[model samples]
Target chain A: MTDGTPILHMKDVRFQWPGRASFSLEVPSFEAGRGEKVLLLGESGSGKSTLLSLICGTIAADAGDVTIDGTRLSDLSGGARDQFRAETIGVIFQQFNLLPFGSVVDNILLPLRFAPERRARVSDARAEAAALSLALGLPDVQTAKAATLSVGQQQRVAVARALIGRPPLIIADEPTSALDANSQAAFLDLLFDQVRAHDTTLLIVSHDARLGERFDRVVQMADIARTTERAA
Target chain B: MMLRLAFGSLRARALTVTMTVLAIALSVALFLGVEKVRTGAKASFADTISGTDLIVGARSGSVQLLLYSVFRIGNATNNVTWQSYQDIAARPEVDWIVPISLGDSHRQFRVMGTTPAFFDRYKYRRDRGLELGDGAIMNDLFDAVIGSDVAATLGYAVDDPIVVAHGLASFTEHKDQPFRISGILKKTGTPVDRTVIVSMEAIEAIHVDWQNGAQIPGQSTPVEVIRQMDLTPKAVTAALVGVESPLQTFALQRAINTYPEEPLLAVLPGVALQELWGIVGIAETALLGVSAMVVVTALLGLMATIFSSLNERRREMAIFRAMGARPRTIMALLVLEAVLTSAAGAILGVAFLYLGLMIAQPMIDSAYGLWLPIDAPSTREALVLLGVVAAGAIVSMVPALRAYRLSVADGMMVRT
Candidate 1:
């Protein structure tokens, strides 16, 4: 249940590719309250990635405001917006999440290097990383190169990275698409345990509808965003 | 963080990194090696002939006089008559005269015929006289004193007998009157190190049977009888003249140059030496220029290496961007990698130059007869190293700015 103010709020957000005639994104409204697990379900070309880009302030909406945890992303300059995102939100991608050259713990502690506020939340970044790795079901191989880990292990490390700094919101874009059916369920279990334990808001975007049952709210692309492709 | 990322990334690509570094190292070494040799050769030449006021020889160029008379480098065009040498020696301004007789060799080493006073008066490296390493000065008519290099190379002991060749080649040998080695001079790091020293009487004795530069087929002079004959040298290639006072050196040089007897040239040794160095300095500068170009080429190779790797690293930049790294951070990482690589290459280049010097010092000494002291880098050399690193920092900006633009456009999009 969302409280008086949701952790993420987007209203009447419109975005279009520059010089492109069609396939513009129009999100009427989107919100995920504090500690809410929201699965944003969308197929390919449904403006899911575009919306996530706007929400993370990588790309600004052409006509609306993106406010996260009571801070308007449009109010911040580009550099300040990046810093704000680093401190307020954590992100996970489908694959290749961790820097392959870094050790597992180094990848987990990466956010602290950029976001000192997030770093200030933890007493010791290395120990916190180790604890988060253990809680995410990663093996005791924090010093191993990230490339050496299996896809499942790499995703768990990514989850640990996302949860390490205790950010108010976590955005995972198709976080389990690389894993097998058995690994996907196990990965979801580990991810949910960490999210719930930290009381962090999660906005996980995926096309697979099977993950909907595990989240508190299921957001479909058709209900929120309207994308119209012009005839070329 | 940028440091860690750069080093980690470079460590990940060890093969390319090592190749780039070696390229830079070799170029830097070449640059510094040329500089070292240029300075060494100049210092050795400057220190070759010291304390001598003027050198008088038969009409020839000043540089030619310096070359053949002092360095024993080439054959003199003409010899000054002994009467002219005596005339100069008899002057009130002249303190001493050490007549130099050349045009002979022993085992590729030049044979310099002079009196015992030559060893006592002739100086190099500023007032440093030749010291005997073994035995004493030549006293016998057929006695010889070999320089340190000659002794070391030919394995000549104090009593070893050596045949004096007529010219630089050993084919026309003065076999009839073999000279016995009486002493060995210590090494002076000058052309003297490669000389075979004998008295003027010995030079006259060996040439008794040879007329007009060739040994007569039917004529032979017995060594015992030749030793008994008067051995006053009739002519000499050149004579090093020292004045009673430095103020009289120019007047004495002019007096010798305008001598009415035979056409003669008297040049101040220090002035002639400077003229010779001016000729050599051109080649040294050209060599330094070529080596500098090599350094620039190596740095360009470094730029190319980083640029070619930039495409593959786009995904890595995107990952950092998602991890909240600004575009500037990505740029800083690339610049850091470049600065680190070039600095490492410059330092390693100095090390390689020292290593090469250690291995090549003996060979160079033997081959060119030039002793290049393997000393520490001079101030100029250190400044050049800093120049190379600064050039690297400047060269790095090209790839860094490109990476900055790329990361900005690639904003968290993990494109393969």
Candidate 2:
């Protein structure tokens, strides 16, 4: 009962793969309220990616209840989980996460095409995409072909894709790793602008602590314990 | 949209897709081609005579009798006595008899001598009754009616008087008994189309001056003068019987076997056709087996093509996943690409078969003596094609599952 309305909430979460030794990720309780910009930092095998999978309803935590937008993620069936992710959540990943053949704009509007409800919510989806492109400093044509662009351009397109439908939650997994420092800063700046413009809750996963100060809250994967000792 | 996307990617891999299509198309062509020919041959054999109950020929295997007398493939070793035919025709169980006299040819076309009743009850095809195409039946003892192919090939028209060059001779014999061509038959797509039909007297007229396969040396008689003498045939090659009932076939066969004058072997046309087919079934089955192997290999070609492209498509899959396409969406795309490719191959295979038939039709008819009706796929054929395309789609799924794993492993980025 920590907040009036938490955009994402995890309670006594425990996740384990089949036949694994122990739970891969454990957290007694954690929550992010609406419009909060949170940063999750971890080493390579610190279960940060696993946590993201849990959050997006890709995989269910073995022994915990997780909620996004007040809907329990684990309770959703296969189809419902897909619909939930497609309509209500957008994810941004590092590196070459794009259909190489599809045009950049097509990539950005992928979620809308999958979930009809999402398409309906964003009336004039292309218009929404166009507006979001302008907000992220990406020209409409930059969404032409994703593979043709530099890493920086691809990251910006990814940002446009994540924020296009005005989804309530946006997750990014070190989306700026490929960019130079200046390009990284610029990409981060474009990302924050769109997130704030749409009032979307942002959770960016990164190992680079130097980028930590920009986020509203920071949670390290080592802090995923079943007690409140690291909550402060 | 997914189908369009898959098709677009396939189009992008134009060469690979084209090769896959060609592989499948060639296999399908072979498969359908062999199946069609085998089926057509069986149909022709069974349908050659619709109304005949029994075939009475010289003592030989039922299949041999059928081949020589009906199909005109081999020559008969013996001839049945005309007295046996007359006695059998007089039997109460026998309704009508159409005597078929063989052993003569014009340009590889066999000549058949039969009574005028052949035009009445001797139906070759059940669907089309026997009706003469031209002038009246052969009451003119020296007249002849030509098969469609004979008339067309030799350019014989009605009322054309031509000599019967006796006894299967291609160049010269029986020059004196030149008979007139009185009528021409329409194409029946059967052995009838390749035969010269004449009265039994005409067959006798040419043989009157001959004995033991040759005209008496320097002993020739004019055909017009032979009309002054006896016109009844001394003997015949075989006889086509239509009995009161199909049940009489066994009894009549026994009667012909026990004929007092001579031993005449009799057979049911349908039974003989079946017996002949069984003999050729091995060759047909072997053909089908090889074509099926071709089909399997073509499908494997599809699989290999997709599998080879799987590594390249890793990046493609990751990119699509990054685009918010789920695993199922990627699967749909891969399946669509394979199915569409296979469908194109099937269509191309059919087209190839058609074009091949059109180009080689005449050669096939003359060389193989086969006619493959170049028509649309029957329902069974359509279903077969659908199965092939679906199987292609399923085969592509093996790659789709790989893509699924790649999308998950790649998450948002393909490392390489």
Candidate 3:
């Protein structure tokens, strides 16, 4: 269920390692509509992570442009790009998602601390975080340190953090690789429920093909990238 | 928010943070302690004798004359005759004179033979006269007035009978004629506080039978016979001269320097004291250099602590980057952590200084005869603290720059 307009658009994007001559990444044209749940399927070394970095504006392309929400990321300065990413995108890492020293609630509220626009979106940040945690099926552990939480609890906390400010786009890389099959299914159900409720666009990159059937559209790395070689 | 993040990071690594802070605190304390001691030594030296125009003594180095006359340190090469002192005092330009005879001690404290004029005219620490803490000044040949340090350390009170030892040694006791402690001077935080003051007659009485630095085996004067004999001093170590006018000091100095009776030298006390200080300043400079090196080492330790943690914190920085922290923001976080630690260390160091002074004040007073005043930091000490913090901020750039580069290179993706 997506709108006609594209939320993320890439055209003629090219990137290469500094001294590597074997393989490079090239995206001729790619677009995801608003509220589209897209699964990017690729092997471990098929340039999926690099493409994700470029999409998030963490790395610049060697050529061409990347636009998010109709704004060209390459047109912005470095600091402005960071601000844009903070306001427009929410990222979830596979491991070490939460800062171990911070409490669960602190981890969820970190995005608001960095992005004022996102913070202004909500009237009460702490209450919203508690509601989001409860909605994600996490226990009442907001006061507990992040390190004290179990892996499943930590994953839910990371999802709650990623969804706190309701950023338009959420990028998760191999988020469910460490979970058991039963836990993975349960996490995916909760993730889709929240994403659908907010009408947020999602792009999850993973080597596992088991998750492809759950997404609205699955894109293969070999189809987009010219070669499927490993990066040094 | 950045501060909160930095504090959170520090809390996560409490052991490393505490070790680095302690290193910085110890070095800072050492640096400030050395500075305090150096200044205290100089102040004690400069405050020993004041308001005296010229110090006249047998021809010798000016520093040696000032040292023996005022500091009670070292022995005079030769003694000036009493006739020379009287002649100099009778001069029209000379207002008053205090003839100081040295070379005796009581329990290792120097015994200074002088008239009551020594207490009246001798000023220290800005023209402050010596006040009597107990009893009265020496009024009899065998009556002695001890300094505050002597009375406090030896537990001597007024009317306590004490034997003066000859030749500045405790082994050679002049027990034949014991002196009574008549008074004790208040603490002046100067070398004067370590002296035992006795009249010239008492000195003469003790040395009546001793000649040429030794007692004749066959001839010894009994206490009664010595008491009946004339007790006028024949020779004195040095004399402190106060001119009728301040402008006459140079002329009188030149006159005394060229006097033909015996080769004699006159030195300005202020100038000689500075010369002595110049000699002692070398060791102080070395100590300062050592302390400075220690501060540098401590800062390097801090840098190493932060730098080594950078690898472990790579994931942390990546998370910050993903949370919209710029490279400069990451750098600031690291630098801010260092600045905070060094600042805390400096404050703790000052606290340690005062605590050490509080505990060691009495011991230092008795051991070195230097009364170190515990007070606020001088401008120089403040500068040292500022220097340490500035160096810390500058040194922190090493790790901060490294973290910035790493975050940029590995954005949102921790390889390890």
Candidate 4:
């Protein structure tokens, strides 16, 4: 994964906390092509969140290599990891995450403030913000204080923020969980379509299988021992 | 950009910032008020004596002597014999001498008895020479030239007949022989403002019937009757003298101390003022210390307010961190936020201080007869406010550190 070969490649990756008696995650090898929409499906306690953390470089894996965009996640220093994660990936949490006090535009502009490289590439950030807001169907007043919006609107703003300045990868963790069924289908359509339009790969994690058909590929996480016993 | 966020957050938490600003403002007001009065008191003291190299009076402490003679703060000790004043004033080193006889007041303001030469040579400060506001200078035996405060308080203009009490102590009213107000002085913001100036002969003529400090029992001497007696003072409270050279002060003092007629003390006005300051310095220090503690309390209150609001700021901090803000960046955000708020509070405090002084100046000058000048913060006070700003910034870190810890946990979405 540390080598400059694949856009994303994982090899024999295992992660466990220091005090834990068991490994929380294990993957011998995994690869995803550029511009791929991959759904990482998991039930409760399947370590989907743990794997997401590993991918984002928020938590270093215990063993093996996990690389994104040909840069090994483990190779990044603490500060560099933060910079790289912001520059390379747009992460969406289950809950719409926004700085409560800041205006919607300021929250969107947050990533570039951390990674100056992203700021340098975007010449017209204000225009991009307007386009991005308009694309999210965010009305002028809805973007004033993010807390003032409905859950669905907030989720869209979060998605807009994730795609703002157009990073290479989008990682969403149950980003549409709080939406109504109709809103969820509409949101998923807009989200995936935007990801395709921007040419960014998306690794979305969700427990619900009903949303699986929307992705190009669906990945099911297995119980390590049960799968091993079945393989034997 | 971070400034915008901090300011926005502060606005969101408007109640906390406003309370902090108000607390700091009151502290500044209190500090400026105390300092103004102290400075004004010192200035008034400085203006009370001028051109007089030394003031000789009956043997006593320097401050008490200065009090009765110059500031009219208290009654003088036993008056120096007239012959003793004469002996000292006759010296070759003495350029001019103004004899002063005290122990009288009207409405608690001192009435001083001196010769015409007292007004002619009496200079409270060298640069601020005597100038009359209206009417001629003292010419008649019982003519009275009033100080600015006395004129304002009693509404006495020139040629107005005003009586003098018998003693320097409060509650005495002498209705027997009232001297006319012959002249009034310009406001000097000094103790002279509260004084009534009359000739030593007027003092002698007015008290002629009162032998050995007692009026003959039931014997009434009318005002017209007093001017008929010999107007020569037996004893004078003090004498103000200008020296040929300041270097001869100690020699002059020794000469006055060893006078053959009576035991006397000569105090250099400058050294006496220093001594008087030493006498009152402890009270001033206590006041300054109290004001300083108020400032410290206000700053701590500000820190405590910010600390309380930090819990609400955790999620905001996590959002910044998740946006690729580094650990130091988060810390910088809080630090910068603290500094700006503290600086803002301090600036508001100074503005509040200026406004308070402006409001209090007239009231203090008229009501308490104390001049509160509008001036820049003293160096010590400036340093205290700066310390408040610094302490405020440091105080902000307490909340920021809490945020930092939350952000660390928030790294893996583990933060609550």
Candidate 5:
């Protein structure tokens, strides 16, 4: 169902940490269409995390342009960028995604607190959170703190959080690195099922090449980045 | 929503949160307690003698006169001669007089020589007259009326014979002519509760045979003979005068101060009481300063607790940032947590203060002759509480700013 225009597009983006001139990220061009499940493969020390930071507007780029859904991210102010991130994109980290002190449902409903658009999309946010938790195969743990849940259950909760409110784009950063091989496959299957049902674009960054077969396309770090190597 | 999250995080670390809050509560209690006692002391001091317009005494500092005459504390510089007292009392504006003759003690409690009019006209704490707990007022020579504390502590009852000492030291007792307790006054929570009242005739009868602070050897007269031998007093320590009208108080004071009979000083009791407080107020301020330091220490402890927890909450902050919370939002949550904790601590502190007052009221009343009334929080106390909460919120900003910088630097990446 994707249109001709890309949902996310980047052109000639360059960034570097303030003190570290030797380390830099240079992306000539990158694009992801709607409903596309793209796996970004990179080794350690690659610029995969930096790329994700650039896309999410966590840090400003030193040069070039990054756009999401026809809006230039650099054009928005810092606070507006945060608002855009909340309303348009959902992110799942490698580990420690859920707030340990929050209840299960509280963890799932956290995004809507910051994003009014997300909150308005659902008729009943709590009911939607419960329904999403059940779809992800979690038990009725509405009152249970995230710390009490197992690693696999926590991962499912994180996925449920990312899927709630159905943002247009979902980004997963090494989400399965902590899980066993069998759990990883199962988690990816669940994540893929949810993304397909929502018709949302997915970008999963990982070092594991074996997981690339499940995505619609695979892009290597070298294909999109140029590094400035410096002496140790 | 932010408040809920702040409270939720606090609940997660319940033990640390409770410790911080308790520290703050204790300091708040101390701070507020010191303030209460200071004002309570001032109130009790001001309430000692209310109806007396002017206190006439031998030329001395106003504070000294107030201490010796009203509080029964310290010694008078000199005695007011009977002629001078009569001259002052005969003034038209002087409605009544309660002549005070102090220099002797009944078992360490002061013995005050006054007339029957003392019991009738003397008022304390806003016109509350001294009530008789038992027996009748002193009328005859060698008749004494003991105060509540003197009666209760010395275990004396009506009609009990008591010996008076020549001075406050209790070294030389007036064993020759002992006095009988004719009455006992009820508890008034003033200096009167710790005094022994007797008629001026009793004072003159006891000192008649004594010459120059001692009894003349073999010259001692019998109590019956002295009673018959003109029991008029030669001198008195001070006298409390009530004016016919409120406007005549200053006029009476001026007249007495410029009396031609002797070098005498007459002071408005309220002004003298304030002067006394001004000297004693330094100690009150010191107590309050110490208590204020304790509160600062408690708040610093709170800040340290919050600052130390920031290392552990780094990942939580990153999670919040990823959930689209701005760095300022993270900072606000931390500050909000501290505000909540200290606000609760201040409330608990006030509760503890009231409880302590309830328990210590009787001891304070009897020991210091200061009645601490259980009352609502005064405006000063309310401001103090507000200041505490505001200070807590401000101090927490230290940790909040640190967390904000960390969240901005870490940026969706959990380093630990």
Candidate 6:
């Protein structure tokens, strides 16, 4: 439990948009330990989404190392990188996270379709998804379409999807911004309970500072990424 | 797995997929139906008169001569005199002559005046000679031999008597000289199916009391009295000529055409049939072109449908990419959907064509006098169906490639 190697690490990582001279990102150093709940707080246009994309291996950092667990994302080929991302990370968006046409349990089991390792990690995927959804405080809606669920119910379904195969990391972009204060509190309680039980590292990015009290630490985008140097 | 996903997406959008498939089915049916009828008509028309070397009649258009003599569609401008018929019959190259006279009708069916020799020389559908299906050939002066269609339509049997009208649309009937049906010819699937055959003497006897196309009021001759008179034909409409050897056909036709005694026309039956096809080939090709265009338009509609849906499905593509689907998987899914849609349409179209043919068989035969054989799809038709599916697959690439590019470029980022 105390080996002291971080589960996520970024060292002097720099990313620049191709053909755009006015914007760039530079992070000197960032790390999240195993079983750490980290809140990344940034305003709407402060590159929170771009940071998450780089961390999830969807986009590459132009300069330095971006590592997840023990693997450097740049060292893997495109196909291997996609497979690694599927096997290691589960992503949830701000709203409308589930595929609207898929049934509730089918959406929950989608990650197993791509990553055979994830599929192998779970036995009886449907029963696992049902148990996950029940633990997340949702009724038995395994056969219902995701589009028919309420906003609170959809968020709970997204949480169940993110935790189905027990991936090592869960990256959620503004996961609680669409919920009310009581529902948000209740959702954080349910999410933290699952994260602790599975020893998963959680990184949720949002501008809502009220959510800062629930995480172990809060990291500000301004303190980590320097965006001053531009070609004006 | 990809195919199952494609079908699921299609099922989600059932209305659009249904309309597109129906459009494809209608066009495919029309395309194959037109081809079927075209081949049927061409075969029936070409099979009308076979084993006859030349058709001779009064000097007129070769097509006109062919129409009146073979198809019985129109009247000859002038009659071929019995003397010219005799002259041609005496040629050494000529093997036999079956002279025919036509100008009268009975119940909208043409009446032909010919001798007993016509039954042996006249052939249709590739050397098939006319055989009496029932009773015997004309024996008495007023005895008639009816075709299968005439007997079936008029409900006439071996002893039924029928009065002949003067012309096709005339009301002047030779009521006193009604002919009795002595024989019914077998079904030949030719113009002969609708003909009423009588002896040449009967034609001349019926007109003996008529002057200038009308029977004189008080000079009407009795049937018994007319039987005693000499009824040798003075003029005949046309004649079918057969050569002793195939090589002498052209020479015999040339000799008849250049005869110094009268102005007459002698045409090779095969050549006239080709000329007729040349005239009708234009309409046939135009019809074929129209049906082909309908197929193309339907395919374009399919392309448009898949293309427009791409915008709404962009978010869905992003979702799949997020789930680790490669770009090529997206492309294959779309192409598979298109292939399934068109393959189903092709099968349904074939079913529709056979069903339509079954319902329209009797009406088409009675209306056009052409028999269409209801048989399995020929090789050409099967190839056409395959071509339709291949075209559908090719047209689907427009949307599939677009979706591939989108999934690669806009990875995990849905704009809408």
Please compute DockQ, using alpha carbons, for every candidate against the native two-chain complex.
Answer: 0.66, 0.24, 0.69, 0.56, 0.62, 0.42
Model 6, residue A15: C-alpha shift (Å): 5.0
For model 5, the stretches where C-alpha displacement exceeds 4 angstroms are: A1-3, A229-232, B91-93, B152-163, B169-172, B175-179, B205-230, B244-255, B282-296
lDDT of 5 at A70: 89
Where is model 5 chain B poorest over a 10-residue stretch in terms of lDDT? B407-416
Stretches of candidate 3 off by over 4 Å are A20-23, A228-232, B378-380
* Model 5 TM-score, all chains together: 0.92
- Alpha-carbon deviation at B221 in model 3, angstroms: 2.3
Q: Pick out the ten consecutive residues of candidate 5 chain A with the lowest summed lDDT.
A: A223-232
- The global Cα lDDT (0 to 1) of model 6 is 0.87
Q: Please, what is the whole-model Cα lDDT of each candidate in the order they appear?
A: 0.89, 0.78, 0.89, 0.77, 0.90, 0.87
Give one digit per residue, the lDDT tens place, for model 1 in B169-217. 7599999999899999998878888899999988999999989999999
Candidate numbers, best DockQ first, in rank order: 3, 1, 5, 4, 6, 2
Cα error, residue B76 of model 3, in Å, equals 0.8
Residue-level lDDT for B61 in candidate 3: 99
What is the iRMS for every candidate structure? Answer: 1.1, 3.1, 1.1, 1.6, 1.0, 1.7
Question: Model 5: how large is the Cα RMSD against the reference?
Answer: 2.8
Worst 10 residues of 4 chain B by lDDT: B407-416
The global Cα lDDT (0 to 1) of model 2 is 0.78
Evaluate fnat for each of the predicted models and list the values in order: 0.50, 0.25, 0.60, 0.65, 0.52, 0.29
lDDT, candidate 1, residue A110?
Answer: 89
Q: Tell me the lDDT of model 5 at A163.
A: 82
Better of 5 and 6 by DockQ: 5
Q: In model 2, what lDDT does residue B74 have?
A: 84
Ranking of all predicted structures according to TM-score, beginning with the best and ending with the worst: 1, 3, 5, 4, 6, 2
Docking class of 6: acceptable
Clash pairs, model 2 backbone: A97-B412, A98-B319, A99-B319, A99-B320, A104-A144, A105-A143, B163-B178
Model 6: what TM-score?
0.84
